[model samples]
Target: MSVTNQTTVTEFILLGFPGPSSLKLTLFVTFLAVYLLSFMGNTLIMFLILMDSTLQTPMYIFLGNLSFLEIWYTTATVPKLLATCLLETVTIPVSGCIAQYYFFFSLGATECILLAVMAYDRHVAVNRPLHYSVLMSIEICLRFSAGSWTGGFIAPLLPTILISHLNFCGPQKIDHFFCDSDPIFKLSCSDTFLAEALGYTCSSVVILTSFLVTMSSYGKIVVTIIKLSSREARKKTFSTCASHLTVVTIYYGTIIFAYVRPPAKYNFTIGKVISVFYCVVTPLVNPLIYTLRNKDVMKAFQKFLAQKRFLLTRNMHKF
Candidate 1:
């Protein structure tokens, strides 16, 4: 149907995960478990950062913002995905799809910027330990956090607007689990050149810029760590950033592959598989990575548990 004659699509069918009917129950269970784990893990990180006085430093502040972002990040799509797995044929209104894309992109961009900020934080800590307190003060941390969020939210606005205005003439089925750029662009009948260009530009600027910043910071950090005479000093310094580096590797690797490609290179099947890593796995693993690797977080968690137990015991005695 020509764009001139056909009505714009008001809704889209999300062909969520091409799989056998027998796998739906497994997929639902798996996604549900992932969502819950991601939520609780990130929430615990936020809670520890808030309550633990020792974790009130600039590093943990960035971590807290990340955890908070992860909660909403996973929330924006996972629940809907869970619903889709259960319902079989999932249809979304145009507006809802747009909203989902905006939030998902915004949070993702925020994470990129935030991760760079964290790398810089570690740089200051390791290379300029004497000036760490002065360099990464509370005010500066808050400003960086606010700027990351603001830039993230603003970056996607124009592209999202462009995508939403495109006419979907027919075959309004999104072949991916969620409303991603490639799948959405593939479905549109309108001239998507401008939209695709804008999407690529925004994605490259956000991902590449942040990736460079993160790598540069880590590069400097590695040099400084190598300069340290004591092996213990070097090990300790690298430990601080190991988790973040892991997350950065996973996130940038997946996102760059997913978003920065030319339209011709899009493989929807592979795209969905890669999407699961960043979308479902990254958020779920972030808290685990940080906590399992960092002694400070473990100590805080133990302390918090001990305090809760003490209070529980005291209350029981009173009762």
Candidate 2:
């Protein structure tokens, strides 16, 4: 082994979205719209849930947590992406790079688990309506919300630890939009069997477990709803479950494609597109999925806004 062989690693470069000068302007606009909507929509949803006591149920409690996660989730990448568009080039330090991926990984993982928790919440609410108060009390709500965040933190520490054992050689270019595990692992010069194995195992456990739990919960819910509730009530209950199921499918499908498979070399364009689906698109779509389908949330939002306006006017008159 020569010195060149011995010196196997340095730094990695991230290549964000590619386009012409005019296209950067277009990308800038599109990214701005996504960032704004993701922020405003999620914030509004959480605000409504918090202000309206009627929305203080277990389901909306999880929704509020999901909305809060969206804020940090999008913030992890969107601002950097927007800055890259403006500066036309950007370099994140290695330390900053790892930290960025840390929180990004955590939040993404938490969201994956949170969606399943939300599914369970709906199942319990609809299927076991009688025990809803006893089962999903405030304590259980807090525990599940905290559990999702805890799992998020726990899931990625293994990968990061395994990554620490490897050294980087040359080939510093990361061929994707952001610093994801797939591209990061690809850039390493060392044999990546251990790291890759861990990646696949973790993805399977996190996603497959969540999916199984959601499905099992829903299966019980369906039978329970039909037996106990009126036809109209059953229809109303399934509507919310269906909407949640749709969002879960879309979000997890993209995630499975990107992360669940065995790690290998990836094409730049394909990776970028898949990354956008999980990162940019999911944050933008999740809030809409719930708000558009659920009338209870809509009514709660109206009530919250009306109360706020009333208070503001009252304060103004007092002044």
Deviating ranges (above 4 Å) for candidate 1:
none
Candidate 2 segments whose C-alpha is farther than 4 A from its true place: 1-11, 224-231, 308-319
Candidate 2 global CA lDDT score: 0.79
| Model 2 C-alpha lDDT per residue in residues 1-319, reported as the tens digit of each score | 1235455544556667777778777888998898899899899889888778888888888989998998899888887777666665566655566677778878988988998898888887876779989989989999999999999889978876787666666566766656777777776767778877886688778888887888788888788768854788778767878877887888888877777765654566887778777778888887888888889988887777788899999999999
TM-score per prediction, in order, is 0.97, 0.89
User: Please, what is the whole-model Cα lDDT of each candidate in the order they appear?
Assistant: 0.91, 0.79
Candidate 2, residue 151: CA error in Å?
1.4
Counting only residues 3 or more apart in sequence or on different chains, how many pairs clash (N, Cα, C under 3 Å) in candidate 1? 0
- Give the least accurate 10-residue stretch of model 2, judged by summed lDDT: 1-10
